[model samples]
Target: MSEPTAFLLAMLAIYTLPWLLWRAAGQRSWLPLVVVQIVGGVLAGPAVLGAVFPDAHGALFTPGVLGALGGIASWAVMLFVFVAGLELDLPDAWANRRDTATTAGLALIVPLLIGAATAALVMRDSVWMGVGAARWQFLLGVGLACAVTALPILLLFLERLGILRSPLGQRILRYASLDDLIVWALLAVILVDAEMLGRQAEFATLFALATIAARRLFARANERDRIPLALMWLLVVALGADWAGLHYMVGAFLAGSVLDSDWFGIPVIDEWRDRILTLLMPVFFLSTGLRTRWEMGGMDVIGVALALLAAIVVGKRFGVLLAARILGWAKGEARLIGWLLQTKALIMIIFANIMLDRGVISPTAFTALLLAAVLSTMLAMPMAQRAIAARDADKG
Candidate 1:
C-alpha cells in the first residue's frame, strides 16, 4: 500500500478500534474510555501486534506514518499539558494552605519514597535503567512517576462522579494543583542538561521576562484574542525550551502556568480541553504504545507493573490516612482522597515519556510504568465510589 493509504488506514484504526472495544466492554464505570484507549495503544504496539503479526504491523506503522503521527501526538500532549497548567488554582490552595500543604506533601512524598525504593530493587538487574541515566536519576524519575496525579483526568472523573463543583472536588483540585507544579519543577531539574547549562539559563531568564509581558498582554486583550495569543505563546515557549535542552512539554506546562484560567473563562477552557481529549489525545496514546518493549520478557514487565502499582496504592493510602488522622477529617475521606490522588493515567505516561526521551529509563521501564498507570487509573473510580458509599452509609 502507498504511504498515504497506510497513514489513513492507521488513523481510522486509532480513532475507531478503542471506542469499539470500550463499547463492547459495556463501558464499565470502573473502566473509563481513556483507560480503554491506553490499553488499546499497548495492544496495537510492537510487543503485542508486532510480535503477533509483524507484516501487518510494519505495513500500517511505517516510519513515515509513525513520524507524522508523532508530530501530531507531540502537539496534542503539549496542548493538554498547557491546559493543565492553566487550570491550576493557586489562590485557593493558599487559602487552605496548611491543610493543602500537609496533605499534598505526605501524599506526594510517601509514594515517592516507596517508588524510589522499588526502583532501587528493580534496577539491580540493570536492564531497566536507561543508558544515559545515573542511579540517582533513574530512582528519582521512577519515584516522581509514581507520585504524579493526572489533573485533567481527575477533572473528568470528578465531573463524572457529579462532584466537580463541590467543595470536595475543589479541595482535591487544590492538592493536585500543588502536586502538579512541584512534579513538573522537579522534572525540569532532572532534565537539566549540563552541556546546555548556558542555553537553559538564557531560556529561563527570557521566559521569566516573557511571562510577565504575556500576562499583561493577556489581561489587556479581548477574550477573542486571548486564545490565539495563548496558542502562539505555547508554540514559542515550547520551541524555546526544546532548544534549551529542557523538553518541550516542560515549556508547554510553563506556557500555561503563568496565565489565569479566568482570562478565557472556565467554560471555554473546559470545552477546549474536552475537545482535545476527544479528538487528539488518542493519537498520543497510540504513539506511546508504539514505544513499549518486552525484551526482558512479558511476564517480567507485568511483574514490575504490579510491583509499582502496589507501591503507589499502599504509599498513597498510608500517607493520606496519616494526614487525615492529624487533620481530623471524617472517616473514609482519606480513603476516597487517596484513591483519587493515585489516579495517574495521562500525567504518569507523560512523565515516563519524558524520562524515556531523556534516557533516564529504558523502553522496558517505560512499558512497566505505562501498564501500572493504566491499572492504577482503572482502580481509582471503583475504589473511590466504594469509599464514598461506605462513608454515606455510616453517616445515615
Candidate 2:
C-alpha cells in the first residue's frame, strides 16, 4: 500500500477505535475516555499488536507513516502543554499561600522521595536506567514522575463531580497548580545539558527579553489576534528550547506560563483545550504507545509498574494526610483530596517522554511509568467517588 494510504488508515483507526471501546465499556466514570484512549494506544502498539501480528503492524506503521503521525503528535502535545501552563492560577495560589503551599509542598515532596527510593532500588538492575543517564538524573526523573498531577485531567474530574466551582475544588486546583509549577521547574533542571550550557544560557537571556515584550504585545492585541499570536509565540519558543538542548515541550510550557489566561478569555481557552483534546490528542497517545518497549520482559515491566503505583498511592496519601492533620481539616478531606490528586494521565506520560527523549530513562522504564500512570488515573474517579460516598454516610 502507498504511504499516504497507510497514514490515512492509521489516522482513521486512531480516532475511531478508542471511542468505540470506550462506548463498549459503557463509559464508566472511573474508566474515562482519555484512559481508554491511552490503553487503546498501548494495545495497538508494538508490545501487543506488533507482537501478535508483526506483518500487519509493520505494514501499517511504516517509517514514512510513523514520521507523519509523529509530527502531528508533537504539535498536539505541545499545544496541550502550552494550554496547561496558561491555565495555571498562580495568583490564587499565592492568595491562599499558607494552605496551598503546605499541601502542595508536602504532597510533592513525599512522593518524590518515595519514588526516588523506588528508582534507586529499580536501578540496581541497570536495565531500568537510560544509557546516558547519571544515577541522579534517573532518580530525579522517576521521582518527579511519581509526584506529578495531571492538571487538565484533574479539571475534568472536578467538573464531572460537580464541584469545579466549589471551595474544595478551588483549593484542590490551587494545590495542584503550585505542584505543577515546581514539577516542571525540576524537570528543566534535570534536562540541563552540560554540553550546551552556553547555548542554553543564550536562550534563557533571549527568552526573558522576549517574554517581556510578548506580554506587552499580547496585552494590546484583541482576542482574535491573540489566538494566532499565541501560536506564533508557541512555535518560536518551542524551537528555541529544542535548539538550546531543552525539549520543545519545556519551551511550550514556558511560552504559555508568562502570559495571562485572561488575555485569551477563559471561555475561548476552554473551547480551544476541549477541541484539541477531541481532535488532536489521540495521535499523541498513539505515538507514545509506539515508543513502548518490553525489552526488560513483560512480567518484569508489570512488576515495576505495580511497585511504582504502590509507592505513589502510599506516599501521596501519607503526605496529604499529614498536611490535613497539621491544618486541622475535617476527617476524610485528605483521603478525598489525595485520590483526586492522583490523576497522572497526560502530565506524567509527557514527563516520561521527555526523559526518554533525553535518554535519562530506558525504554523499559518508560513503559513501566506509562503503565503506572494509566493504572493510577483509572483509580482516581472511582476512589474519589468512594471517598465522597463514605464522607456523606458519616455526615448523614
Candidate 3:
C-alpha cells in the first residue's frame, strides 16, 4: 500500500484499537478510557508489536509515517498543556499562600528527596541514564518525575468523584496548581544549557515583553477573536522556546499562563480543551507508545517501576501527613489529600517524554517511569474512594 494510505490505516487503528478493547471488555471500571489509551500506546510500541511482528511493525510505521505522526503529536501535547496553563488559578493559590506553600512544599520536596535516592541506586546499575545526561540531571529528572501530580488527570478523577468544585476539591486544585508551576520550573533548570545561558536569558526577556503585548491584545479581543489569536500566539511562543533551548511544552505553558482565563470564557476554554483531547491527544499517545523501549528487559522494567511506585506512595503520603500535622487539619485529611495528589498519568508522561527527548533518561528508565505513572493513576480513584468513604464514616 502507499505510504499515505498506510499512515491513515495506522492512525485509524491507533484510535480504534483502544475503544474496541475498552468496550469488548465490558468497559471495565478499573480501566477507564484514558488508562486504556495509555496501555494501548504501550502495547502498540516497538517493545511489544515490533518484537512480535517485526516486518509488520516496520511496514506500518515507516520513517515518513512516523515523521508525520510526530508533527501531530507535538501540536496535540502543546495544545493540551497550554489549556492546562489556562486553567491554573494562581490568584486562588496566592490567596491561600501559606496553606498552599506548606502542602505543596512538603508534597513536592519529600518525594523529590526519596526519588533522588532511588535514581542514585538505579544509576549504579548504569543502564537507565541517558546518553546526554550528567549525573545531576538524571537524578533531578527522576526525582521530579516521582513527585509530579498530573493536574489534568487529577481534575478528571475529581470530576468522577463528584467533588470537582467542592471546597475540598478546590483546596486540592490550589496545591496541584502550585506544584505544576514548580514542575515546569524544575524542568527548566534541568534543561538549561551552560553554553546557551545567554540565549536563554534573551529568550526569557523577549518572551516577557511578548507576553505583556499578548495580554493587552487578548484583553481587548472579543470571544470570537481570542481563539485564533491564541493559536497564533501558541505557535509563535512554542517556536521561540524551541529555538531558545527550552522545550516547546514549556513555552506553551507560559503562553497560556500569562493570559486571563476570564478573557476567553471558562466554558469556551473547557469546550476547546475537551475537543483537543478527543481529536488530537490519541495521536500523541500512539506516538509516545512508539517511543517505549525495553532494552533492559520487560521484567526488569517492571521491577524498577514497582520500586518507584513504593517510594512515590510512601514519600507523598509521608510528606502530606507531615504538612497536615503542622497545619492541624482534620484527622482524615492527609490520606485523601495525598492520594488525590498522587494522580500522575498525562502530565508526568509528558514530563518523562521531554526528559527522554533531551537524553536525560534512558528509554528503559522512561518506560519504568511511564509504568509507574499508569499504575499510580489507576490506584488513585479506587484508593481515594475508600479513603473518602472512611473519612465520611468517621465524621458521621
Backbone-clash count (model 3): 0
User: Relative to the true structure, how large is the alpha-carbon lDDT of every model?
Assistant: 0.92, 0.93, 0.88
The Cα RMSD of model 3 versus the native structure comes to 1.3
Worst 10 contiguous positions by lDDT, candidate 3: 27-36
RMSD of 1: 0.9
lDDT for predicted candidate 2 compared with the true structure:
0.93
**Model 1 shows how many backbone clashes?**
0
Q: Which residue pairs show collisions in model 2?
A: none
* Residue 288 local lDDT, model 3: 85
Q: Looking at candidate 3, what is the lDDT of residue 305?
A: 91
Worst 10 residues of 2 by lDDT: 291-300
Expressed as tens digits, the lDDT of each residue in 1-396 for candidate 2 is 999999999999999999999999999999989898898888889999999999999999999999999999999999999999998988888899999999999999999999999878865788888897888989999999999999999999999999998999999999988898999989988999899999999999999999999999999998779989999999999999999999999999999888999998788878888989999999999999998989565688998999899888887888899899999999789999999999999999999999999999999999999999999999999999999999989899
The model with the greater TM-score, 2 or 3, is 2
- lDDT digits (tens) for residues 162-238 of candidate 1: 88999999999998999989999999988887899999999999999999999999999998899899999999999
Ranking by lDDT: 2, 1, 3
Q: What TM-score, to 2 decimals, does candidate 2 have? A: 0.98
